[model samples]
Target: MSGHTTTFLDGLEALAASPLSPALEETTRLRLLDWLGCTLAGAASERARLGQMLASAGDGPAPVIGTGQTVAPLSAALLNGMASHVVELDDGHRYGITHAGGPLIAALLAMAHDPRMDQARFLKGIVLGYEAALRVAIACQPEAKLNGWHGSGVFGVIGAAMGTAVALGFDRVQLNAALAAACTSASGMVKAFGPGSELKPYNAGHPALNGLAAALAAEAGFPGPEDILDGPHGLIEMLRGSPVPPGALSVAPPYCIETVYLKPYASCRYAHAPVEAALRLKAEHGIAPADITAVQVETYGLAVHKHDHTEIDGPYSARLGIPYCVGAALALGETGMAAFSETALNDPETLRLMRATRVTEDPALSALVPAKRAAHVSLTLRNSSEVATQVDLPLGEPEVPLRAPDLRAKFADLARTAALSEARITALADAVLDPQTDPRTALSDL
Candidate 1:
């Protein structure tokens, strides 16, 4: 391959061979903790229970998250991946627009059952996985999403495969073969987020299943596409249309995980902006739910187009509806798991506000999306008062990240909700944050 054309292969080789820095390792460690909290919390959900049933057949050593039951490695990967994403609380990268930690962490955990994978190898695997997914995402860009393909489902196939390959110690050729296989498996429709969204979490699991299959296929010496990503009519061309960006393949250092966004709220990432705005208004003015007469949220195109639903009957739609999230944030001053609970769903005041709210796709804000993700909110009060606020970067973005204490509290909150004892929660958090702690031991208590 020519130097310019070899970007995909070169990037794959570099990330697979590169060692993560200590700082990045710590970041990875924190995200691991964050991921476990999401998994444990999600395991209690109805969706996660269904995932367990689907993956219940595997009897391998890999443990599905938050349960003592062991399943086959692939099943474990699928269940854990699905659980992590079920709550919409997993880590997300804006550029890639996929929750990277779900598939990456799930694949790595399933692979860790070998008892030979060290903590260092585990961390490196996650970095490489994010690298692969992020590169693919960059190439696809707005074009992929514009066409209704979910990046997590499409980009994550190769990413999860790469992580599995890293964990299994695959060489360049085997990794390429695995990626080729993954390309064949890439799929997911944004339609899953529409009405009757039960298939949404399954979209997250698809990558884990397909990715592991690709890696295992490579290890078994099953020949697959070697140039499936960059060749004519390859994965990129098929998904992104012709004339894809050259920079998409130009892999750089410091990796993609450096800017990963962890969730501070349980709602969709797209809704966080309005949620934050509403929360800020409530906090600053100390307004009760009854004090607000109407709310208007203006945001970017995708958020308005996909997330503008006014009625949220269940947890699934509650997590996806911007109107519900903003109303809940305004009413309760928070949008965590509690806000999506059954009680929260029946909240009369919140329902009233949700019904009264308006969400529109602002032309200016829409123009800035996939870049700024900004949102503007205007609230009208009962006593002839008005308030407005805007947020460019939501709280969990790297620019305005949750502090260490807040991160700890977030995890502690989820751990408690998952019924973990104080001792087990503390030990798990300690192990997850400690650079030297093995991932296997970190998960032992769970």
Candidate 2:
């Protein structure tokens, strides 16, 4: 399992042969549905304006998720992935910092709609992509995010390329070439979030497009390095600032599917635990919004970086703002897609709550994140009565997983905002759960 020997192609081969659990398959399918719903909602958003422009430029037969128009496969993946994450409501793996479902599902659906790709292979490719992204993210480890890179774009390129290669039935050599090309083309920066730049959504979309381009390039007789991930100028060295460790590319059982955290809240994953803690305290003590005087949240080191919003504004800002998310949860008793809206951000009560909320980094808690994402919140009442709640496992943690019912409910909630019909919602959920039944057929009705 030497790093050089364990190439992306090798990982893809292992994943293709790996046995997928029925439950895992169901999870993957449901995630697809959730991401599709997000994409559909974002199709008309100003955040997705770039995606719309790109979609209009292509005329291939690949279907965009919400829109009826078809574009080139790469173009569709880029647009769909961009739109899916435009609202920041898409699914993300907490540890990986990669929005697994966004790019992966976008590319899978674009390929799935192609008559040449059978449903079974399409589904398998999606699973393979998930595993690949997770592994690459893990191998890159702490440096993946610290080095001013977006894991979804850097590692996601590898995952999307591997997934697309699988769906296209590339031989091992071709798959290796595709991955090499992906490794070379992958690029994203964490700086996009710092300034509330429109580039944030492109972080999700660009990797998908690069990945598809990699696969297409490989198919068109391009040659790539056999050691793209471990070479001196490889992805790990360039993006991660270190060579990938030996045996870093092994594709194990369960993969990252078991470790992936489905987001229950639309905000940053770092903020979820604090919000959960606050919500738990509010629910248990029956604390009203006016009863809170101040709130203090102790979370990982990243919380300080995320919550330090002296100039927060707009939905994107709220989504990345820890104080805003915690305050909204405390004041509204919930934090969902609706809570990140412009109206919600400008709410007087939410601002008051945000002003009262203070966030700090706890080394002890910081050590537990990515795997745990734990947090502790302290609430002080108007009368100085204090209550504290700590959450080690939030709602969507791998251990405290969200059930099918909860996922369906979340889909419906998002659909309500998107104006999707009840029938459309049900059909979308069913088509994802049973992807063999042509999910596009359900989209047609929409």
Using lDDT as the measure, the top candidate is: 1
47-89, model 1: which lDDT tens digit per residue? 4465548554557877777887767888888888888888888
Per-residue lDDT tens digits of candidate 2, residues 1-446? 33653555566696787656777777777777777767776775653565447646577767776667777888888887788887677776776777766787777766666665666677778888888777778777567788778788888888888888887788877888888888888788787777655577777788888888888899898988677777667677776687765667777765676667777888777788888899889899999988888988888886677565634668777778878888888877658877877777787778888888888888998898666677889999999999998888778767888888888888887776767789877877877678357555565323
Candidate 2: where are CA atoms >4 Å away? Answer: 5-8, 18-21, 47-55, 243-245, 440-446
Model 1 accuracy (lDDT, Cα)? 0.81
Instruction: Please list the residue runs of candidate 1 whose C-alpha ends up more than 4 Å from where it truly belongs after superposition.
Output: 3-5, 51-55
**RMSD to the hidden true structure, all candidates:** 1.8, 2.2
Each candidate structure's TM-score, on Cα atoms with residue i matched to residue i, is 0.96, 0.93
